[model samples]
Target: MAVNNMAVQGKFITFEGSEGCGKSTQSKLLLEYLKAKGLDVQLIREPGGVAISEKIRSLLLDKANAVMNKECETLLYMAARAQLVEEVIIPRLTNGVILLCDRFLDSTLAYQGYGCGVPVEGIRSMGLFAAKGIQPDLTILLDLDVEEGLLRRGAERDRIELRSLDYHNRVRKGYLDMARKEPARMMVIDGSQAKDVIFTQMCARVEQLLS
Candidate 1:
């Protein structure tokens, strides 16, 4: 269960997308499939479920903290990520588990760097430091149009999702850009399709990776 040995056995795969794009749904389906196949899997979401990360998530998402600055918000996200990585992700993966993260570092880059207009370099630096060089083996990006995605959510906007339409558009563009830049490590999925169709394709992609 040492770090070096874990890195060799475990695989990290992350799902990323804007709100209402069904990343969560797909992630759940994938997790179930992996479990059924008898693979050791761990599911984690950002901003998060772990003790320390959950506290940071509360601060980041609380409507009452409306005055939090953009940079401060980004840093808070990094803090949560650092804790989640150190406490949960690293340990679980080290035990040879397949880590299926609902949202990972890409969310920070999309929401903070592109949507909020923070410099991409700064966000990347912070992410690198937070994750301590751990990178997903594959990143599945569920791509969708901002307007269509917003309509799907139907008035259930969280603090991040409540941003301007223009901001959401930029975030989507940012994800596409990242996929393009890291073609070997990322796959862009058509998220506008029906849920079953998306799930089927997701399974195929995962099967191919495992094969």
Candidate 2:
């Protein structure tokens, strides 16, 4: 279909996982696939890229900001999300684009609420408010063992990555909990496999959904 002629039944799909789980790579692959199939697609990531949001992202990722409190970090994430939603996601969706987001509100819940031991209720409420009730049509959680993921990433650990192993464990558990809670909306994919295998499984899942 021509991009301008496409109806605005936009679908939001998110790729999520701990560091080094290939969320970025998979998101890019799916985005390319959709575009090749003649679907309108938009690619975006959280905490950065957009002007105000990029500033917040830097703060979130900068080790100099290490003194930032857990609640504050969560709030900053929500702030960036709110701006992202208003400036990027909502507009693209309204224009009939398939949104392929690298990460979404789920990351905040996994990292902040579970990993940092913040209250889940508060985090959920904040996320809902920030997103204006917009939830992804599908969330692909690339599941992997925390230790394996960390080891695979090697020396490429960033600020968020420098967090304790226990924190990552909690985040992984949090993602599993979310999958259990929202089985229809979330699919857990094994990330220990080869990239092509993972991509094949993802394509299968998307076909099932779009069929």
Candidate 3:
């Protein structure tokens, strides 16, 4: 996949991994830390950050939409991302805001590209087009087993979460492969560690980025 890995003006960091990898928690923690230091920061999530994107998120996550076409689902995600990047991400970052996003292009590559069998090149083209050259400066991948991550999510599951174990495994492998290819921009953290330890390591990464 020929992804446009160009660096944007401000610091943009994204968190990625399988569902229920504690990224939400870690993101919030990092946000709190940045705020304490009085840095100008903005936090967001994929597929549901902005109002328009939130609507698309509901359709994508609804279990009743199991029959949704893979390509269609993929496009819907890109639509949400396009709106988010236009309405929220790009503007704030243009003013030099430090962005701590919960997820980004990597999720699509892992879920739809690897999980649902969409070609990486196609997803790359569509995603880069949608986001308008925006790319994270750093991506922290919280690596974990599919089973354990799902177990943490509990009985309630989204449509994507209900996919087969093999599918989830492929997604995890896809993330690892990306990390291997872009070690400087993507760090794979062991998600099985204690929450505090994980956060500490995450903080260290963010510190390095900020410094």
Measured against the true structure, the TM-scores of the candidates, in listed sequence, are 0.94, 0.94, 0.95
Over 116-197, each residue of candidate 1 has an lDDT whose tens digit, in order, gives 9899999898888898778888888999999898998898667777788999999999999999999988899999999898
Each model's C-alpha lDDT? 0.87, 0.88, 0.90
Number of the top candidate by TM-score? 3
Candidate 1 Cα errors over 4 Å, as ranges? 1-6
| Decreasing lDDT order of the candidates | 3, 2, 1
**Ranking, TM-score, top scorer first:** 3, 1, 2
**TM-score-better candidate, 2 vs 3:** 3
Candidate 2 lDDT by residue in tens digits, 38-61: 988888998765999999998899
Q: Name the lDDT value of residue 125 in candidate 3.
A: 92
User: How large an RMSD does model 3 have?
Assistant: 2.6
Clashes of each: 0, 0, 0
Q: How does residue 172 of candidate 3 score in lDDT?
A: 97
Task: After superposing candidate 2 on the true structure, give the runs of residues whose Cα lies further than 4 Å from its correct spot.
Answer: 1-8
